[model samples]
Target: MASQAFEEIAETFEFLDDWEDRYRHVIELGQELDALEEEFRVPATKVDGCASQVWLMPAVKGQGADAIFDFRGESDAMIVRGLVAVLQALYSGLTVREVLEVDAGAELGRLGLDEHLSSQRSNGVRSMVERIRRIAQETL
Candidate 1:
């Protein structure tokens, strides 16, 4: 289940005439995200498979399957940061159970991100999705 924020991005991507414009939109989205606090950037939060340094701090409210799943993330690379923002839109604010139920690749594919991104970037996205899913699963 894609969030409304993610759907808006998809809609914007559809409205853009070219990949360059869409790329810029993604970068702009990244620029809009709140900066991750330094304390949250430690080794334990770091996502290993990304080419650039990336960290995600998961936050949960309540308990068990109904807990809300939210996370804040940052990346040293601008495009990667944008990807993180995209992930935020895709997954944030869902119940932990809902987060686990999401088909991340399918939802992202609707935006045609799979075709536009480089292999390394694609792998990084997968890594991020996995991390998000793992966090949700553990919370459950």
Candidate 2:
């Protein structure tokens, strides 16, 4: 089943006619995310290549085919935080194999975000995706 968070975000994006409005909605989504604990924000969990500081931690549950990976992330920048929220919506609760199978770049492009962000911001998002996919691969 699709995550309720992702569904709600996609629906909200579809309803917003303007890119500016969409950006605002994304920021709002960021605001809704809980802040990561101080200890979890350490360098070991930090994402490299992002223009802003970002930390992501993964929690795995169950075993074998029934396993699910949930993520918790935080970013210093508001927009980056929003991007983290988007990632969580799409990937959290998915199995490692399922996460590895997702075409995150294509999905971001479909959301019109790829065209709208600055190159740096886009690269930062890609870095986050790469890290998540790498973690998924390691789990497998």
Global lDDT scores for all candidate models: 0.92, 0.86
Minimum summed lDDT over a 10-residue window in model 1 is located at 59-68
lDDT score of residue 82 within candidate 1: 95
In model 2, the Cα lDDT at residue 51 comes to 96
Which 10 consecutive positions of candidate 2 have the poorest summed lDDT?
1-10
Q: lDDT by residue for model 1 over 15-127, one digit each (tens)?
A: 99898998999999999999999989999999989888999999889788899888999999999999999999998889999999999999989878899999999999999
lDDT of 2 by residue, 1-140 (tens): 34566777888888899999999888888899999999999988999999999999988786654579788999999989999999899888888878877888777766789989999999999999898888887777
Cα RMSD for candidate 2? 1.5
C-alpha TM-scores of all predictions: 0.97, 0.93
Candidate with the greatest lDDT versus the true structure: 1
Give candidate 2's error at residue 26 in angstroms: 0.7
